[model samples]
Target: MGYTIDPTIIRDRFARSTNEQLIDIAENEIRSLTPEALEFLLDELRKRNIETSQIAELEKKVTRQHNKNVSRAHSALAQDLSKEGMKLAVKMKLENASNSDIQEALQNTGISSEESLRIIGSLGEKAAAMNKTGNKNLRYGVIMLLLGCLRFFIIQSKDDLNETIILLLVLSGILFSIIGLKIKSDAKKISEILEQESLEAQ
Candidate 1:
């Protein structure tokens, strides 16, 4: 089936991604393009960087695999679905079930575990995004608070020789920095997982 390509959407994706990411996307798209277009595309890439050798190797490998393909049909493709089960799956999805929960609920519904997880993962992504955004805010807030407190303490220390107060300020800053870094690290992990999953699905 043919779908419309939105230029704005394409530009936005390019805007949000790096050149290396765009290169990977082009590699996948090359498999579906005509030989003439593929050659032209590779020539353009070569002009950008001397990396067409790797591109040529990848294209040859995937093309050979495509030509020699001999895999069995998927089981899910063979089974028919019941209306009620389909409705239940839809409802479960709409209710924001987790990946594990969806897979369990969709058990014996002619869906493969991989496919079930993929569907649920797409829905789960929204929750992850919200969580990532909140975590990002928390990290930012922590950093700002630490900076503000440090500034305050530095100003206060200039006019006083209170060892206890300086020690407390230093300890508090260390503790807050550690917590903020941990939160930032966790948020980074979530973002990377989502990005990796998205690339794999593509």
Candidate 2:
């Protein structure tokens, strides 16, 4: 069976390809894509290599391409790949981004690779997963969750427990829930901002 080429995969490989490999692609499979599709393909490479000062122009061209004649899937794939280059500078160098974080995050933020970027891309607090901030959140969340459970248990175990202690435990549980919700919200926003930056390498 024939397999569809994943445009981003082609762009990713081509971005890293040697001149000889590019020639091979040109002589073979590259012929299948439309000229506009070809432009979109090359744009992905340019996105990563273009200088900062020139990014805005390229971005305008990219956005325009979105509404062009290429296959919608191809257009989307090209856009996603080009987008990755947008966030490369800030995302890769983030204090918590991995050693592999730089490469993986690039691949990820670039959306060159699939799926896992959600966790590390956002909560990679000050780095990749389990970084100082993420770890702290993980530890703290776990402790708070546990403490909340303990407080509930204490109330259950003692019907006569002081009203003050009961009130304090009630406040602790609510506080834990609020903080947990905030962390979850923050992680999602971070991931989204990072992803958006990739769209223009901002």
TM-score of each: 0.28, 0.27
Q: Pick the lDDT winner.
A: 1
**Model 1 residue 59 distance off true place after TM-score fit, in angstroms:** 77
TM-score of 1: 0.28
The C-alpha lDDT values of all candidates are 0.52, 0.51
Task: Return the clash pairs for model 1, or none.
Answer: none
Error of 1 at 5 (Å): 65
Any runs in candidate 2 off by more than 4 Å, and if so which? 1-142, 151-161
Model 2 lDDT tens row, 4-54: 467666556667776444444434444455544456445654545445545
Report the alpha-carbon TM-score of model 2 versus the true structure.
0.27
Each prediction's total of clashing residue pairs, residues at least 3 apart in sequence or on different chains, is 0, 8
* Overall local distance difference test of candidate 1: 0.52
Per-residue lDDT tens digits for candidate 1, residues 1-202, read 1112454554454456554754664665544543333343444444454366775665565455334332212323433433344445445644544446667776667666765655555543544554565566556556655665766666666545555555565566566556656545544554565566668779
Model 1 clash tally, residue pairs: 0
Q: Which ten residues in a row are the worst by lDDT in model 1?
A: 69-78
